[model samples]
Target: MDATVFEQIRLMLWDVDGVLTNGDIFISAEGESFKQFNVKDGVAVALLAKHGVKTGVLSGKQSPALSKRCEQLGLDIVMTGIHNKIAALSAICKELSITPKQVAYIGDDVIDLEVMRHVALTFAPADAHMLIKNEADVVTQASGGRGVAREAAEHLLMSRGLSMDEVYKPLMDAWNATVVVQ
Candidate 1:
C-alpha cells in the first residue's frame, strides 16, 4: 500500500462489537447485556484524536454500553443502530465535509463491506471474518479487540513520517498524566 493513500485519511471509522470488543456479545433476558473492550483500543482512539484523525464507531446494533463507551472515547462520529451503512456513511461524510476518498474504515465482519468499499482505505483485524480480511486493503497483525486500532493508527502515523517512539510517547504520557491526587 502506498503511504500516500493513508495520508489522505481524515476520518477513521470503526465497527464496534467485533472490531473493538472481540465479538463476544453477552446477551441477557433483559437484552444486550454486555461486551468487553480492550483498554488498548481506548488508547488507540485517543492517539488518533491527538494526531488529528477523527475516530468513531458505526455499528449495526446499538446498546447502552456501546453508547457509553463512545462517549468516553470522545469520538467525532457515532452512528450505531445503523442498518444501512452506506447511507449512514454518506451522511457522516457530508456532515464532516469530507469525501469518501478521505476516509478509512476498519471493520471485522460482513456487515461492514459496503461502507468499507466506499472509503479511501479499508482495514481488517487479523481475526476478522474471512470475507472481510480478504477484501481489506490492510490486514492488521493484531486480532480484533487486541490493539488492532493501535496497529492501524501506528501505520497511518508512520506513513506521515512519524517514528514508533514519536507515535507512542504521547500515548504513554497521556496515561501517566491521568494520576489521581491522594
Candidate 2:
C-alpha cells in the first residue's frame, strides 16, 4: 500500500484464470473452452487507460477467449502459454523501457509469485490462494471474477490523489455525446 509503489506503476499486468475469471474453465462437447469475464473489470481496464496506466496479460494457458478479451481491452502486451514468467516479464520490461519496479502485477496462483515479487506493487483477489494473498502488497476484498479489478483501479487512482470522477469524465462525456445524438 505504499503510495510510492503506486506512483511508480506505469504498467499493470494481470493473470487471467484466477485473477480475472475466478479460475473456472468450461468446455463444450466440441472441446472449445470458454471463460466468463466481469464487465466491471473491463471498465476498470478502460479507467486505467484513461489514467495513463497501461495494461497487459500473462497467462500460463492459451485461450481464444482470453485473446479476444485482451483485444477488446486494447491491450498490446499480452503473453500467453508462458512457463518462465520472469523471462517474459524481463522481455516486457525491455520492450517498454521500464524496470520491474515500474510495473504492478495481480495474480492468484503460485505461478505468479516470482513476477509478483519483482513488481512495484502486487495484488491478489480475496479468494486467491492463501500463499498468494500472503505475498501480496494488497489483498482486494473483492474476489476474482467479481470487482477486484475495479477495486484495484480505484486504489491506483486514489494513491495518486486522483478521483474516479476525474479519471472517467472524458469517457463519460464522449458516451453522453453519443447517447444524445441518438
- Best by lDDT, which number? 1
Stretch of 10 with least lDDT, candidate 1: 173-182
Per-residue lDDT for 1-182 in model 1, tens only? 77788888899999987788889888999999777888878777878876788988888989999888888778899999999999999999999999999898999988898888888899999999999999999899999888887788888888888899888777667766753111
Error of 1 at 147 (Å): 1.5
Clashes of each: 0, 0
lDDT of 2 by residue, 106-174 (tens): 999898999998888989999999999999989999899887887888888788877767767855766
Once superposed on the true structure, which residue ranges of model 1 sit more than 4 Å away at CA?
A: 169-182
TM-score for predicted model 2 compared with the true structure: 0.91
Per-candidate alpha-carbon RMSD to the true structure: 2.8, 3.0
Candidate 2 residue pairs that clash: none
